[model samples]
Target: MPVPGFADRWRIEPVGAMRVPGVVFASAALLPQVAEEEALRQVANVATLPGIVEASFAMPDVHWGYGFPIGGVAATDVEDGGIVSPGGVGFDISCGVRLLAAPVTLGEVGAALRRLMDRLGVTIPRGLGSGGVWHLPDAGALRKVLEGGARAAAQAGLGTEADLRRCEDGGVLVGADAAQVGERALARGLHQVGSLGSGNHFLEVQVVEKVDDPTTAAAFGLSASQVCVMIHCGSRGLGHQICSDHVRLMRDAMARYAITVPDAQLACVPVRSPEGRSYLAAMAAAANYGRANRQALTVTTRAAFAEALGTSAGSLQLVYDVSHNLAKLEHHDIGGSERLLCVHRKGATRALPPGHPDLPDDLRPFGQPVLVPGSMGTASYVLTGVVPGEAFASACHGAGRTMSRHAALRHVRGAELCRRLEASGIAVRASSLRGLAEEAPEAYKDIYEVVATCERAGLARRVARLRPIGVVKG
Candidate 1:
């Protein structure tokens, strides 16, 4: 099949043992690159898994990854032989984006951008294993974080009950089993909560440069030139440790279950099986850790902003928080019947359309907020979910990485990129210049093109566009 340009989607007809078809959403110009990276092969490989429903889907930002392509979406039937793969959730479980809208504008903070950024830099710790944000005190306190997520963080005086509803799953995944998590995994992340991780993860201070839809902008309390904070982080070492732990368990269990996948990275077990339940429970606990992590960071951030900008932290209200890497058992219409499915969205965001009951009462009328952060010094987007989305109510996460970190570092010096971004009015602060170079804007796909493709593909609808003023990376 020659890649399509104008077609809505390019379908990969099943061959051999694929259980379902493969679909890649990209423009004709992007299709060649997608193929060049062999991301399509990963999509096809995902379709071979047991109990895969409908098709294996990829967003326009699709790129090569371990098991499923980055931006991959796949659902498996629980009633059938549905299985859960660790690769589907990625190593950074619940790695996601949370955006806070502020009443301030660029005019108000533009002068103090450096000071504000400096405060944020000192407030939020960075890099892998660099923990110090919140001292959990002991393992039992850590267990509360794993079990209760942001709500627990709130109870600890981090935020408030008002913040709970603003987060997805009310800042808690109900079924997290902290006991399933090993002490080693706990040790990896117990102290890392609320800190930004290395590579890709960042906290950016931005301004709403454009409001694509006034009604949505109003609903989201966003206006042109209004300042906002975009936080992109995850569960830190805890999630990585959990994923690594279960991949080993599942790899061992697969033989006993008589299951085999096209890729060893795609190691998995049946969702209803004992191993599967254990993994899910542990994953949930890690996810809760992720939520609590972001919440703590949010509170820390609010204080930093207040001290730097001389405003109350309460003024920085949360717009929405959504995880891009996760596996959630959601109900969807399939074959004319509602069935529960383990929807795995790696490097993808959930785009539930307007009227979703899960949406908070304040945001139900507008739709769930889909936060897509672009590359360094690039434009981020705030989108509203579209009803009956094409890809399991999912959308692209970031402008999916276009190159490897090594490739990016080889292409440009971090110091040079930082100078260029600063010259463009974006204040850049990174843990290291070398790390900054690895995340240069050139290392990722065009956010505009990617979001447009998603809109064209009916995955999400744009609401507003965010432009960065200051950035801090880990």
Candidate 2:
């Protein structure tokens, strides 16, 4: 078959034993951006993996990454000798986004914005090696968190069962094995729960400006003029360590299996292999830690909002939580056959269509809520998964970065950026001025464009738009 074409920006061709053609999603304007070639090359590289059932795909935000491109998505059949690559999951296991709708409105908190930002800045740890209020847990308790996920956090008084119901996978993935995790990984994660780590991670207070889908908005308990909180974070050092540990292990296993690929970073073992199973187990454990971490942050956020607004936690409700990183066990139809497959999503959000059994019952009518956060000074969006020709029911994760942090620092100043944001009525706080420069609004692609593309591509539908009132970064 002639290579599938996607505008002038993408060139897709079949390679190796790929059961389907590769699909690259981008536009003419983005073609030059992808000219670097690594991401598209990685797309082809992914096709060479054993048992890959469908087209190895890349979103418009695709960029060169460790193993898979940052926006890469792939699914493999386990029974057909599929393999799992740690690089496909990325280091930030379960790096996700959470949006909470508050009972208070923007008008109520507009004047106290500075105070709220200050309080959040002081309370939340940021920057490198920053610590939070939570004490490090022992290996035994940590293991429980790895296995039980958000439930473990709620039992420990971090949140309630209701929080889990609003979270993806109920905030836990089965088969997590703490024993497979290393001591160093646990140590790095112990004190990091509830802490907001650096690099594209943030917590922002926002106001709902527009509700595009009234019915879905009502189902998600969101309304125009309502205030909300958006938290973007990940598994922290623990997840990083898990990826590092497995990358090295997989490299060694590759040698034993005599596997050769275009890139060493794509090193992997059969999903049924001892090494692969152990990596998945440890990865799940770290992912659980991430879910627990976000849950803990939710508790803190509720407290802050309650204290700032003189309200109660009972009135603060969670909207939804979804992770963009990490691999999942899912069943999808391939060539008209329903088969169990391991779907790896890096910098890609799960956009399950309506009536999926995995979605929260209340949200089933609305489909899975997809939160796409922009840079601090930009607008975020609330979206829902739509059913069509979904490769794996996935969507874009964020206003994907357009420039490197170092490049951003070279062009922007912290003070100037801060002043511009404040002038626009958005409060800003950060652990470091240098860190602030790295996240300059110009560093990222226009989220508005990204969301539009997602809609045009039939991946998701926009439900609401959010404007930031205050942002806390670390």
Worst 10 residues of 1 by lDDT: 1-10
In TM-score terms, candidate 2 sits at 0.95
Worst 10 residues of 2 by lDDT: 1-10
Over the stretch 127-211, how does candidate 1's per-residue lDDT look in tens digits? 8567857889889999999999989999999877777878999999988999999989999887898898888889999999999
Q: Which parts of model 1 have CA positions greater than 4 angstroms off?
A: 1-7
Relative to the unseen true structure, what is the C-alpha lDDT of residue 3 in candidate 1, on a scale of 0 to 100?
40
TM-score between model 1 and native = 0.98
Clashes of each: 0, 0
lDDT of 2 by residue, 76-108 (tens): 898888888888899999999999998877776
- Checking candidate 2 for backbone clashes, the offending pairs are none
Best-performing candidate as measured by TM-score: 1
Q: Against the true structure, candidate 1 has what lDDT?
A: 0.89
